[model samples]
Target: MSRISIIGTGNMARALGSRAVAGGNAVEVIGRDASKAEALARTIGGATAGTIGAAPAGDIVILAVPYAHAVPLVRQFGDALSGKVIVDITNPFNHDLTGLVTPEGGSAAQEIAKSAPAGAHVVKAFNTVFGHVLAACTPEDPRPLDVFIAGDDAGAKAHVSSFVESLTLRPLDVGDLTSARWLEGTSVLLMRAMSGKAVRSSSFSIGLTVRD
Candidate 1:
């Protein structure tokens, strides 16, 4: 069982923490607010709670905060995150949601990688899935959700893929860290698609199917 530490007390954090618990993995909830973190831990059932900067108990740290806060959060964590796999779930979409807000030629995951400690492995994931859907399994489909992952380190990617599989979710490796740019774009596209009146349901998710 993989130990997981989720940063942020928002919906995404709760979603991931709940899934980790359901998967029988150890979970730790960290947030800026101690009360919220504790409450979320209690809600998730079987998670420890702490504030930001508290040494993470999980080898995999998932950042569920806003894209703008990702960089600074990494900087603050510094070497404390060394040797840990850092999962970047933020979508760097513009406020208007017209497009991604990533710096030219750089995705949010890449930017976070730059600020992360030398030994930290940064992986981009969960940007394409909606949080509401993440909180629970898809209603119409009994299968687990698909989680596309991109990262520079093979070992890191494998670690994340294993964690995803542990939760019964499909982990699709879309190549190295640079592929995160495309993933971010996909997130923007999904956001636009969901915002349109054509799709009224929130239980659906984006996935890949391969026939044998």
Candidate 2:
């Protein structure tokens, strides 16, 4: 188990925070609203609350914010995030849901990396699934959830994988950070699928199956 700091107090924060606490990891919820953060932490149980601009106490920092705010928020964190593993879980979708909002050939994670301070490693993950679905997952669940991770640093990827494993989920290492763009694209497809353009159902999470 690892110390986890989630930089948001919304649905994703509560879902992930609860899972982290259940996994025996130290969970901290950071938000612009101090009271909201405190309330979320209390609801999650066994977790701490923090203000947005303060230095995160955990080595692993999860950005549960929106894509539009991710880079600016990273810049705001500045040197305080140095040497921390920053996990980006945002889908940079266009307003109409027709496409991504990131610049051509760029992904939300890559843009976030550009704003990250020296020594901080940014990894793309947790974007392919919705918060409610993630919240439903547990170590005791019979079904498996596949968490695809993409990052430039091997140690950082391994560190994130450990946290994913703590929830009893599978971590699929797709490749280096360059693959983040595809992961973001994966989310776009998921959005459309969940919107009924591709799939007629809403009760599903992307899963990987391998057989020998």
Instruction: Point to the candidate with the largest lDDT.
Output: 2
Residues forming the 10-long window of minimal summed lDDT in candidate 2: 195-204
lDDT string, candidate 2, 31-128, tens digits: 98899999999999899998788899999999999988899999998999999999999999997778889999989999999999999999998888
Question: How would you encode candidate 1's per-residue C-alpha lDDT over 1-212 as one tens digit per residue?
Answer: 89999999999899888888988899999988899999999999989996698678899999999999999988988888999999999999997778888889889999999999989999999888888888767324477789999999999999999998877788999999999999998888787777774588756788898799
Best by TM-score: 2
Per-prediction TM-score: 0.96, 0.97
Each model's backbone clash number: 0, 0
List ranges where model 1 is wrong by over 4 Å.
138-141
* Over 4 Å off, model 2: none
Full-model lDDT for every candidate: 0.89, 0.90
lDDT of candidate 2 at residue 167, scale 0 to 100:
74
